[model samples]
Target: MGKLKKIETEIEGVYIIEPTIFGDERGFFFESYNKRDFQEIGILDEFVQDNHSKSRKGVLRGLHFQTEHSQGKLIRVIKGGVLDIAVDLRKDSATFGKSIKVELTEENRRMLYIPKNFAHGFLTITEEAECLYKCNDYYYPEYESGIIWNDSELNIDWELKKYNLKKEDLIFSEKDKRHQSFKEYKKAGGER
Candidate 1:
């Protein structure tokens, strides 16, 4: 058995994964992903896609989801740090609308698993950051949707000042700047 521990968060279907590292003068070694170990922890989905992204400090990426091809993701940071956020959007789930945040850094070597049907996003907390993620599904631009990062109703703490940043300091893709509000999304009939 690999040295992996899966920690459940307050939100159902979300998990924090820790792997035992062996280090010496040679450096450190650990299995980043083991199918058997992951399956043992009840994460059964087969991830088909891997994505890597590098963002500069004060870059806020998402709160994005897909109405049709929703994706479940297992994510970790390979360089620098980020405050990753996941929001439950399963209408029937008891924890619907609740969100959880996890700090991922290269030093910690931690991963966050967010099941399908959740909105996911993150803010770069250092000068620069690189993130790697595995997704159970492929991307489809036509079905992509997102909630505004600062949606008042969702009430996520982006920690601008804590990172020595103001909202204006954050950089975003033009598309992300036009995402709908959480309240408006629901009112328009969710998962449409």
Candidate 2:
């Protein structure tokens, strides 16, 4: 039997998956994604896009979501490790504005599943880290939107304090900085 660990939070559809790891003296092995198993477990989304990114410590990449085409993400660390995060941006959801954080490392071999309508981001815990993810929809550049990672309103305990982040090191795009706050977003029906 596979090991299933569910994190029940106020968030609507955030899941942390720790698949069964088979380890011997030689090494360890596990199924990152199995369609049959996923279906059995009710994760039936067909991932149509995949993305990979490499980042150095102190490089923050996001609180991003596509407005027009929401995407569910199945993410894992391939090379190093990171503190992955997802924020429930679905306005209609009871958990809207809530966020979940998880650590994905090479040794842990764990993956996170962020359903559609959630904003996703991560911080590198190691000097260098690689993140790979499967998406339910192709990335729509025009529809992409983001929120400021350090927005006081979200109050995400990014744990960046431990990393000694400087104002300049907290990188963000102009678009991200201009994103509406949680309250403003909800008033406009951010969820679809």
* Clashes by residue pair, model 1: none
lDDT of 1 at 39: 92
Whole-model lDDT values for every prediction = 0.93, 0.80
Q: Show how many residue pairs clash in every candidate, following the order shown.
A: 0, 0
Measured with C-alpha atoms, the lDDT of residue 65 in candidate 2 is: 88
Candidate 1 lDDT over residue span 39-107, tens digit each? 988999899999999999999999899998899999999999999999999999998899999999999
How do all models score by TM-score? 0.97, 0.87
Q: For candidate 2, what is the TM-score?
A: 0.87
Best by lDDT: 1
User: What lDDT tens digits, residue by residue, belong to model 2 across residues 96-176?
Assistant: 788888888988878898999888888887888998899999998888877767667788888876767666676655666
| Model 2 CA deviation exceeding 4 Å by range | 1-10, 163-168, 173-178
Q: Which ten-residue region of model 1 has the weakest summed lDDT? A: 183-192
> After superposition, which runs of candidate 1 have C-alpha atoms over 4 Å from their true positions?
none
